[model samples]
Target chain A: MRPFLFSKSSAINQALAKKNGTTQYIAGGTNLVDLMKKHIAEPESLVDITSALPAKIEVTAKGIQIGAMVRNTPLANDAIILAKYPLIAKAVLAGASPQIRNMASTGGNLLQRTRCPYFYDVTTPCNKRKAGSGCSAIPGENRMSAIVGYSDQCIAVHPSDLCVALAALDASVKVQDKSGKTQSIAFTDFHRLPGTTPERDNNLPANALIHSIEINENAFAKNCAYVKVRDRDSYAFALVSVAAALNLKDNQIVEARLASGGVAHKPWRWLEAEQYLKGKTANAATFEAAADIAIKDLRAQSHNGFKIPMLKGAIETALQQCLNR
Target chain B: MKQEYNFSRRFFLKTSSALGALAFIPKGVKAFYEEVKNFIVPKKEQLPLTVSINKKSYAIKADTRTTLLDLLREDLNLTGAKKGCDHGQCGACTVHIDGERALSCLTLAAMVPGKEVTTIEGLANGDKLHPMQEAFIECDGFQCGYCTPGQIMSAVACVKEGHTKSVAEIKEFMSGNLCRCGAYNGIVESIQKVAAK
Candidate 1:
């Protein structure tokens, strides 16, 4: 734990520029605080960027453009977001407690890490932490671990409920770099852990700051939602979850964009599942077929073997709700 | 099946507030906090600040490490905002900043210089209590009264934000403030009572 200076910046690029690889920009501090307490994030300098980012939420022609600093409560209550993108609103509301969502930012929520208990306790050997360190969750308490995105190197789950919904919605993340250059990364690639190196969560450099996130206008997404199964009722991470967007034609599934969580290193887009449902009735058989195809490659841990069933049930329920709606 | 941590913290606040006043964690919590503190000893800095609280402007110099909760209780000698958990997980230390209910535990004192702050003490006009505060008392909205200030602050904001439509909406909006006394049924009743007027 090194003692470092704390800097306040209202400019995202300037705050990122202050990063010497040992500094992290504080957005809402919701994720960072837990990591800091667990000794996982030991950055000496914290650049407070909340003041610099405009906390704006507006219905743009493209979709909803949520500022980096916009709190979840307002987003959950935003009349437009609630009406037009109820999935986003529901996802935002599903995260943790009200205190967490209040202090949580749009950018930070998208960047939140997996809640694998092994990932937090520094003593546990984790591939996501020290490269090549064997995954402790392989044989440890991994009931909440990933069943999709399973590989020899890493298999921890993604934590963001909102990100999964955004992934299905094809959301874009706006970023500003130290050089004041701006870029946008689509939600599919916004978070990555193809594991060969698990430490690099996103494609963004340490000197790049997230600005805002834009959820694309997908008619199917407007009718979507994020549903989670967790150990507890409140303030707990997901055990298995699904973010689903579906459009039906004459009571038959015409289009579907389903992404699953608590089952992957990132929001695992069930494209095979969605493709299977094309021109099919959104009944139990169709859902079961998609769920079966979605987890075909999964090889979970001894404790997390249940995730296969949990994630499958989650997708089935989410898709059914979409069909019912 | 996952072990049930089914006990909701919101339910805890709905029923109890004062009688169950103790640290939420086990005895191991002290050691856990100390270990975390060893990792988070922020390099301290100093700054001068002036801010109005409960109608009086408090002029003071503060270390950047001081949180709004610390400033209120330690600096201004206003101990109404209890510090149940300094980590922003609990809403024990809540105050109104420019009419918006905010967590004082997570708020930096230095960032509040220009804001008009209001604590539980300011909710009364002369000898008259604010309608929400009076309703809370009348409905026995609190058990221990420890989370009363934060609950009152959130209740005031709930009405102001027009979250009085349904019990679920009010619960969703007011979820930020945790009441360990579980006096939430009465708390909601109190808010419903004042919102009726």
Candidate 2:
């Protein structure tokens, strides 16, 4: 049964402040409500954080600071962000159907749970739920599972397309606490695994409010863009996705950063591959070597074994496209 | 008790008869019934949300169980927004909050207490329609008009935000608002017209 619920963003923080661990904060209700209907998430006392937080997208000294409350459409069209951070715009555009984007936030996008079939099926014995419980998805139907940085416990891919962009951008998140204290978490370290506790998807405690995602002014800022391969044109998660950024100096690769989504438990970064890419004259061959390194030693579930090559191809193709553009 | 028993018996028979007749009902209706199971089954808890629509304010209570789309159409009598999907998958119930396009279906009524909300009903200058409404009608931007309000709202924002640099740019920006009517030609034309002036 769905939980008896009350929704107040402030009340959510207050309730979290008062309670032990029995409430969930809601934004947009796109993912949470959908899961609730599927009987995947049985949240009691849903604290609606939609109205409580102010939505904004601003240019800061560090870089672009997008409030966690700002919707996808605003971010996708923000003039400075679109021109300065086209990867964010492209990534936001490539996500779930437009209507869902209208409701989904960058913070909620990062905070989005996995889209695993077994995870949603309440009857399934998923390790992401009860630690040490066998993961039905690992063997049963993991065609859409991870291809990199995976563990035995869980292989479900992060569903947010926008998160891949933020990860590539090396975005930092600011979260407000119940006591009104604020703390910042790096984009990559924000999401955790279902390891023994596969249920815990994010590092944010119950009372923490995701305030903003601060994009760092890195060398890859202007050159990055997101590309995905999905079953449908839009609204579906990727079979393989790539967020690639390149900075060329003197016709040689001065810097390159690559991150992949829909193919990992977290936003899988290719730091080794990126290091390999620097000081090389970028071409399809250079991208191929880096992509190969990125997918090296990946643990793929049954259906996802095909994703490694697909991801490599996707990254190479996206890199070439950006270079050409 | 006798009359009550008769009413119960009649009710059961009526239900059975309806079920019998429903054998010819479409598969979609059966699926709809199955999908609506949660809506009918009330959980242990619910909360009150006092909200305002158009310009008038309401102090009514709502189920924490309700979506803003249902809260508006079912309880509040503002049926301007249509429910294409209870999921945020569709932009049928898109409305304006402080002049920005928002999906009402994805929003909960309890969430918007002190904010100003403007639905399709409130998008007129004394029955003379907002420029977007008139432009959409003149350009035939909508076919069914079901997704029109959302399209209009998003289109206005797009132009105001100055995303009409090129057709590709407009398509990319407006990609969030879908018109299954295949009226992209008109939709683009309408936005281009508004954006030009």
Candidate 3:
């Protein structure tokens, strides 16, 4: 919470123009402010962009467009999102408490940092915080580290339940650049696999700003659920979570979408398992098989090996609940 | 790349010219420019803040790094909102911003200028206590009462948001407000009593 310059912007171009490597955007201030207070993030200048971005929840023939500044509570309680995309709503509600949901913005949720204990303790060596400093979680306390798509540089997991559902729903993120140019990034490709540069969380450029998220209308609405297994029932990060959506016809699955959280650097979308579930009967056996396939490639650390089976059970339960719904 | 550079340059010129035109306007636009300038630049790390708290407007100067929780307790002497776990984990600093519950500990003071903030101090109307506050007292919702204010604020919001239909829902919605004394039963009862009406 060091003294920093603060500016408010009502224009996107103006905000983006002032943004750079040392300047950070503030919206809701739930995650960013916490990081700043912990000294994990100390930007010299903060450009408040809550007013600069649109806050509308517009529904079109193709899909729904959620503004970046839309608070998590309103997004979760919105009639369109709750009815047409209950998985998204459930995932959002499962993640944080009511007060947090009131202040957390859609775009800020996507950009939230990992909740690794080592990352928060500045005295420890964390590559994500200080590049090339070596990751403490690699050999230290890593019970919550990533189980898949992790490099030696960092093993932290992305702690977001909303992003998992968005990945399963095939959402798209709209971003505007400092030059006033815009581009769309698919939800699956929005977050990056932690490689040499664990410092870079997502594929977004330094000067780019998230505009909105577009989710297409799909048949998974009737049979979808977000199952999160945590240390506690509420107010805790997920130990393993699953966002399952299935299209069932005549007791058989026509299509399926499965993604996992709390186990990877990004939302782990098991495309192979999703493909395997299709054309199979919507039963416990099919779900168990899909869950097995989903965990086959997961490489767990010494302390987090339990997450492998825990994630498998979560996936099975999520699929069963989706079918039952 | 070339087109992007040209566009950015043109945008800068357009904005500067717009500001230049505003400087010549008689009164209204000039005052607007002054407001915009104040918002864009922090004067010596202290900014002018106009916030409405407890239905009272206060024009004050706050540091750019000051959080709403600190501003309330340290500046305004509104100590009803306690600061527990200064981060967003504990909900001891919960307050209502524009009728929605938010963690004041995480909200910066600069962000509440145009919004209405209602803290536990504002819950009681002079001599009459709020329904949720009265219910908390009737049910003995707290043991040590350290987290009572935050719990009461969240409870009121939970009922208004229609999440208090069942015991499980109330527990889930009020999970942020941690009561270390383990008086969860009374807290649930308090919320239930208010929701029943």
Candidate 4:
């Protein structure tokens, strides 16, 4: 790792004031430090913002607000999350190891880079690592590449489990700039499709710090499930995951939110499928049809054609599990 | 001429002796030379940090880039935490920060000033071993022992966090600490033993 200066601040405004092109912010240091060690990231200086941001999980009149610095472990085990927003808790627990969850921050989890092999290797050609370098995953080992919302430049899928749940929950991210000005960005709009600029993972403006995540109270909390299919039963990245939330009335679906991971550049969701489920009876057949609509536009790579059926089954299963309880 | 000759001979003797003694200088003097060298070609950035570890405070000048794992093992000589996969993949460098398990290798030394860091070395009281340590020994929880310290630290946290209720729970919580020797059976048994108490 390269030698760099480290500074810490307890004030968000003061920390953001020092933000520049070469100075990166450090919180939890789970993903950033690993990237630094691999030479994938070489910032000239690191500003430790772990203490600068609020770490509390607050309940508001509209919904709940989770501070950016809140660690994953506490967020997963929080009483409110377990009782009311259980899907978020389940997704958090399904993602990483216990130690990682203890150290990873909510903001850092959203800002984490993709787990694409080429992006991490640094030697391989990856448009996400360095734009226009060419995407190796398109022609190389791409069993885990994105099957939807991908462009010719990049085929990497977003690797965040929590983001998928947040997408399903219609969560919004609140960001503050250096001047203390704040703005709320909807969760789906926050992460960007690879497009031509895979290097820019999200729509977050440079020098803006994520302050908190706002999740409004919803009826889908009780009937929600996050199903993750991975190589390992635990401590592994999802091969295809689904976060399914439904609002039901007398065996009929009143509303639905379905999002998938490991399928697209962002948390993959189809409004057409979500709209199709409304007023429909909650059963395996309806869910299978919804799953079919969700994968209608999916274009698979050479090795990831299996994901089409796998994701379809996962979607149906997630909705079925949500109906069980 | 004889006086001049004596002065020149004395100067030559002093210079020669100083040059010859450089090879056998003490370690402290050699370290000072290194400082002087760094002053000429400055590459390292140093910062003063006071960290509390195992209920003891240490004030040391650390390189700004030094991680907590490196500080404990390399600087402080507390080698219990093994540096397996310097990245966060392997849990061999697990330590407790404020009673929560964290990957020390990913934690920069600078981030730990105001926190309490407990490692495997601090798990015992006086000459008595911690119950987790005793349980590990009784159950033969390790073979190679490289990952034992980290596994023990995580197991202690797991039990405290109420995650040791079932065999599957123990296995899931302890999945971060990879034992390449496949000593998982005994490790799980050890956690169960301690949790049962």
Candidate 5:
């Protein structure tokens, strides 16, 4: 890795002011350091913002506010998260290893780049790494590439389990700019679809820093499950994962929020499927119908065509688990 | 916003003089530019880091890119924490940072300035081995013994965190530390033995 300047900032304004296009903010350094070592990310300066950001897990009147610097381990093991947002906790636990979870931060996880092999291999041409360089994953091995919301420029999927649950929970991201102007972005809109510019992952501006994530209190606590189907039982990325939460009243689904991972550039929310499940009986037939609607518009690549069936199975299983709970 | 400046005679004279001086002494100008760059931008050459390891405080100068695992093994000669993957995938580089298990390979040395690090070398009380270490030996928790240190460290933490309620729980908690020799049975037994006490 190339040598870079490192500064430890204790204030948000100081960190934001120091950041330019070539500067990156480091927190946890689990992914950033690894990417740096691979020469994938060569920032001229690194601003240490771990201590600069708030680390609190505050329970506000609207809902829960998770600080950006909160580690994945604590967030997964937090009592309130386990009770109120069990899907988030389960998703967090399913990602990475225990040691990694202890070091990864909430904000860093949201901004993590793709795990596509072509993207990591600097020898290969990747549009995500270099704009208009042409994508190698398109014609090469792309079993893990996106099945929806993909462009010819890039097909890499966002490898995050936590964000999938957050999307289902209808979370919002709070970002603060250098001028101290703050704005809340809906979770569904936080990550961008890989249209023409796959180089830009999210809608976050270069100067703005993520402050915290706000999640409103929902009634899907008792009926929520995060099911990640990977090649292994643990410590693996999802091949097809489902985060299902259904609010049932008198054996009828009053509301449903379903999102999928390992399928798109952003968390793939099946709004149509969610809308179809409303007022339906909690049974296998209803779940199968919802699953069909979820995968209806999906267009998979050559190698990842199996994901359509796998996604259907995962959605069915996750809904069944939620209904059983 | 600051006002943008247009080209002027004063700016041209200032630039021409700087170029003329550099033309007269090209080597000297290059050296001066490097000196100014170094003075302005902080390089990774000599970063002052203060960390407490095994209850011993050490003030050392490290490169900004040096990982905690490299700082311990290369700088401090603490080779007990092996670097199996060095990418945070394998648990062989697991160490305690402020009593919590973390991957030293992924952690930068500069990030551990105010935190306490506990490696495999600090697990015992002089000649006496830590209870988890002893349990590993008694249960034959390792075959090749490469991943033993990390397994023991994670086992100790798993028991301490009260996650060793059953064999399944131990397996789940210790899933991060992989043993290629398939010594998982003995490893789980060792954790169970320590948890039983």
Candidate 6:
């Protein structure tokens, strides 16, 4: 790794003012350090923002506000999260190893780059790594590539199980810029599709710091499930995962939210399918139809067509689990 | 043909003139030129750090790019924490930062100034082995023993976190520390033994 200046400060505005395109903010350093060691990322300066960001999980008028620096393990095991947002806890637990969860911060996890093999292998052409460079995954080994919301420029999927649950829960990301101005971005809009600018993963403004994530109270806490299908039962990225939540009244769905992972650049959400499930009886048939609608417009690359059925089954299974609960 | 002696007056005059010109350059411009030169050249940034490790404090100079794992094994000579993958994929570098288990390889040494770091070397109290270490030995929890330190560290944390309810739970919690020798049975038994106590 190249040597660079490292500064630690508790002032957000000062850190943001120092941040440039070549400067990075280090929180947990779980992913950033690894990428730096691989020479995939070479930041000229790194501001240690772990102290700069808030680390508290606070109860708000809205359900809860998770500070950007909250570690994944604490977030997963938080009593409030386990009780009020069980799917979020389950999804966090299902994603990485215990040690990683212990060190990975919430904001860092949201900003983690894709685990696409080409992106890691510097020799390969990865548009996400180098803008305008040809994407090797389109014609090369792409079994783990995106199956939905993929443009010709890139076919990489966001690899956060927590983000999928957040998308389903309609969480909002609050950010602060160098001017100390703050704004909230809906969870679904936080991550971007890999359009012509695959190099840019999220819509977070440059040099802005993520403040916190706000999730509103919902009735689906008791009837929500996060189902992740992967090659292994532990410590692996999802091949296809689903976060399903439903609000039920008299055995009929009052509202539904579904988001999928490992199949899209962003957490794939089907609002139309969710809208279709509303007022419908909660059952396997209805869930199957919803799954079909969710997968109807999804197109797969050459090697990732299997993800279509995997995603459909994952969605159905997750909804069925939610229904059973 | 014979090689000629090349100590020419013209070369000496040119070198002296360049040195004379450099001496006349303004201090600010010279500093700027040095800054540009530093950017073009790769140089290690050495910073003074005071870190607390295993209840002991040490003030040392470390490269800004050095990982906590390297600072432990290479600088501090605490070789108990092994580097398996050095990429956070393998748990051989597991250590405690502020009593919480974390991968030292992923942690920059500069980041742990105010925090306490406990490595495998700190687990045992002088001649007395930690309970988790004793359990591992009693249960034969390792074969090659490369991942033993990390496994013991993770197992200790797992038990303390109240995640050692069953064999499956032990396996799940200890999945980060991979034992390529397939000695998981003994590892799980060791964790269960410690948790049962």
Lowest-scoring 10 consecutive residues by lDDT in candidate 6 chain A? A2-11
Better of 1 and 5 by lDDT: 5
Cα deviation of B67, candidate 5, in Å = 0.4
- Model 5 chain B: weakest 10-residue lDDT segment is B38-47
**Deviation in angstroms for B166 in model 5?**
2.5
Give the alpha carbon lDDT tens digit for every residue of B39-142 in model 1.
66765556678989987987898875567888999999999998887766667787887777777876767667777889998989999889998898889999
Q: Could you give candidate 2's per-residue lDDT for residues A214-279 as a string of tens digits?
A: 987767655676889987665678898889988887668888878888877788788999899999
Candidate 3 ranges with C-alpha deviation above 4 Å: B1-44
Indicate which candidate wins on lDDT: 4
lDDT of 5 by residue, A165-196 (tens): 99999999999999999999999999999899
RMSD of each: 14.4, 9.0, 12.6, 6.3, 9.1, 3.3
Q: What's the fnat for candidate 5, on a 0 to 1 scale?
A: 0.70
Best prediction by DockQ: 6
- Cα deviation of A1, candidate 5, in Å: 1.3
State the lDDT of candidate 1 residue by residue for A1-325, as single tens digits.
2344566887665676687877777766767655665678777777778788869988888778889899887888888787777888877777776656667788888788777778877887988877788888877787887776667777787888888778888888998887888889988988886468876677775667788888866667435767788875555578877888777767677788888777778887988878998899877888889988888877877887787777888888887787655
For model 3, residues B1-197, the per-residue Cα lDDT tens digits are 44534457789999999999867789987788889987676344899999999899999999999999999999999999999999999899999999999999999999899999999999999999999999999999998999999999999999999998789989999998998999899999999999999
| Superposed Cα deviation of residue A51, candidate 3 (Å) | 0.8
**DockQ of all models, two decimals each:** 0.16, 0.27, 0.38, 0.53, 0.43, 0.72
Ordering by TM-score = 6, 5, 4, 3, 1, 2
Q: Which lDDT values do the candidates have, in the order given?
A: 0.78, 0.78, 0.92, 0.93, 0.91, 0.92
**Residue A261 displacement (Å), model 5:** 0.9
Please say which candidate is ahead in TM-score: 1 or 2. 1
- Give the DockQ (C-alpha) for candidate 6: 0.72
Give the runs in model 4 whose Cα sits over 4 Å from its true position.
Answer: B1-43
**lDDT per residue as tens, model 6, A11-42:** 78878988788899999998999999999999
User: Model 5 over residues B1-197: C-alpha lDDT tens digits?
Assistant: 99977989899999999999868887877899999998676466669988899989999999888999999999999999999988888899899999989999999898898898998999999899999999888999999999999998888889888988888778878889989999999999998888889
